[model samples]
Target: MSGLRDLTKTKGDRLAYTATSSSTVNRRKRSFILSGLVALFILVAWLSGYMIDPSHLSTHLELRNLPPSLVHPFGTDWLGRDMFSRTSKGLGLSIQVGLLASACSCFIAAALGLAAALGRTADAVVSWLIDLFLSVPHLVSLILISFVFGGGMKGIIIGIAFTHWPSLARIIRAEVMQLRSAEYVLISRKLGKSRWWVASRHIFPHLLPQLLVGLLLLFPHAILHEAAVTFIGLGLSPHQPAIGIILSESMRYLSTGMWWLAFFPGICLLLVVRSFDTVGEHLRILLDPRRSQE
Candidate 1:
């Protein structure tokens, strides 16, 4: 939004910070480590699910409320379901929702953002609509939309995409507007390149790194939000295993000694959220040229 912005113009420390953020630089090592950890969890959860039928059901009322021990690593719930298996499976479900929802949101963001950047009447309408959506809390918007759409995977995807795209669209619009006049972009147009050609080749490519960083940040939010909705009984069906559902069911037994029922699943959720945030922060730094320079 600032007039004729230049990446090089910065306070000393700011420039240093930017330099440190260059995505293509030294931090690849740390980024890889963080990413690998997430991948490992996903792989383990996925493979474990196929090998074991979590629906077999456990029946041990006496051992049901036991603490974490060798036989039941994460302990047992009220129904005697293995917290380890349920928690692991729940993670898979959570990540699935997060991945699908975030992908949909990012796609919507890109499309709407490009539309807004075109500077047309349609762009104005989209701007106003996006603003209206943004005015409400994202969680509330998602909840309302999900309820309207009939609470399930379809609803979750639609709700998340609809609620979250506004911010990304606005950010991308600003970026596109800035890039539209950049040296590379202008040069492409001056050479008689098609509008689409210039935007696609010069403008969009420039936005990719930052967009990726933003997406990584968005993933955790989507996952956690989905879990929250489920916890409140508005998300996934109770028949299916999910982190929220597991915890929500566990609430009835909290006073009992079976603390591990909620404990382990909660830990799994925490790790996944933290992992996403860690990667997102690192990506934000790496993608910003100024940070890289810093």
Candidate 2:
């Protein structure tokens, strides 16, 4: 009787484990599908904006200040420019800037993070720099940096790249520190393998997922900051039709009751930002072992 009871318990445990595994697999599939859909949406938006002709955005005084309609989906701006075109172009530009900035920041983070693993002194210096950057507000630091660089696409990208790396750097540093103690790494060290060889061969492959997620997560922040600085006259040129410039210019006409001027563009920016954020979060969950099971 006792043997039969044990057999039943083992079967129950197996069933439970199978159910959990199934659930995890389903969750991962859903996450992957959602991420793919959001990514496709972003790609479409970027391409539409990138490919639009300048002539389509030319001012039409007769169509100025129109509200959202079937023909003008997002409506017309005060300058008679199609807000849809302007928003799309602005979002595309923002995405491009965000990509560059995030990639640059990731490079910085990876370099400093790997360097931190070299020695106690290197770790301390990297930690201090991380803390120093974190101590200040991002927007404030970004503005100062942009101003220093004379505030253009170049300034904005450089400013964002410099400001965004500390958080990701800290993550990479912690990951490397933990990885350093792993049995494989320790054994490689004992086998007369150089530190650089071990890091290149064993460590970097593990860091790639974290780096990719970090890049996606940093993108939204970069876009928002770029828009903010530009809105206040410190980012892109006024003639550039950037979202910031759109919002800033819209302010003057808001009291006159043209809501779509700022409304559509602002909403579009938020949508793009949230889409990237969602993709990053889903990728992070998929990549993380502990969270993947949940």
Candidate 3:
């Protein structure tokens, strides 16, 4: 009778544990869904504001430097331009640059990584190049590259795209190399299938997840670097309504007690970058099978 009671208690404990674990998982899933929806809403709102009208951000001397109020939610800058409008436009432009640069960088990494995995000679050369690029400070390299290209939107895009690929390329090359040595790849080779054909049909599909994750991770870096270069006067033109330009212009007026000029725009930039980082982290967690178990 005691043995029977002990067995029943053990079974009850197991059921309780299972219920608790399931509840925890349900809560986490709900949290993830809520986070995703909020991020999407913020993105859509910003995009709508960006596409609304350029005239909205135009200078209005009379409205200039107005403090935050119902009339101007983010207040007005020294030039009397709507701070909210300027911030949205500037952030939108930064997103454009980040998307372009991140895409280009990913393409470069994928191409070089595939090339390296295709041959030993190519692998050695690519490895050396990766090392060379990594040896230099990214900012210094970005500055030199941007300055050489005349320091504007074009320069910033090209500079960021070229400088950001090395680490990703290394990761991709290692993954490809491992895949190349797998049994199926070996069998495909033995069956008279060309390396290019196998890689295109098999390897590329496997690479998509990694490539996507890398692209998302690269976005925040690209945006931040673009702003940094612009702030240091080696990036986009001041005439452009970029976050860097807005922040740079705000510096001169900060001492005059127009703290909103810098504070609002800077905070907005940080929020956008952080949002991208969060999305990327969540994406990685979702896509990784081992992490999904956790």
TM-score to true structure, per model: 0.84, 0.95, 0.91
- Which scores higher on lDDT, 1 or 3? 3
Candidate 3 wrong stretches, greater than 4 Å: 1-28, 31-35
Question: Candidate 3 — which pairs collide?
Answer: 64-80
Order the candidates by TM-score, highest first — what do you get?
2, 3, 1
Once fitted onto the true fold, the runs of candidate 2 whose alpha carbons sit more than 4 angstroms away are 1-10
**Residue 90 of model 2, lDDT score:** 88
Clashing residue pairs for model 2: none
lDDT of each: 0.78, 0.92, 0.87
* Model 1 TM: 0.84
Residue range 208-268, candidate 2, lDDT tens digits:
9999999999999999999999999999888887889999999999999989889988999
> What is the per-residue lDDT of model 1 for residues 1-294, given as tens digits with 9 covering 90 to 100?
453244445565687766765644556666667677775765676566556664534565665666788987998776676778777778887888888888888888787766655557757877887889889999998999999999987888788878887788888888877887788777877889877777677777777876787787788889989999999999889987889999999888888666777888898889878877877776676566565454
Task: Tell me the lDDT of model 3 at 45.
Answer: 39
Greater lDDT among 2 and 3 belongs to 2
Instruction: Look at candidate 1 and tell me the lDDT of residue 26.
Output: 58
lDDT of 3 by residue, 80-134 (tens): 8888888888888898899899999999999888887677898999999999999
Top of the candidates by lDDT:
2
lDDT of 1: 0.78
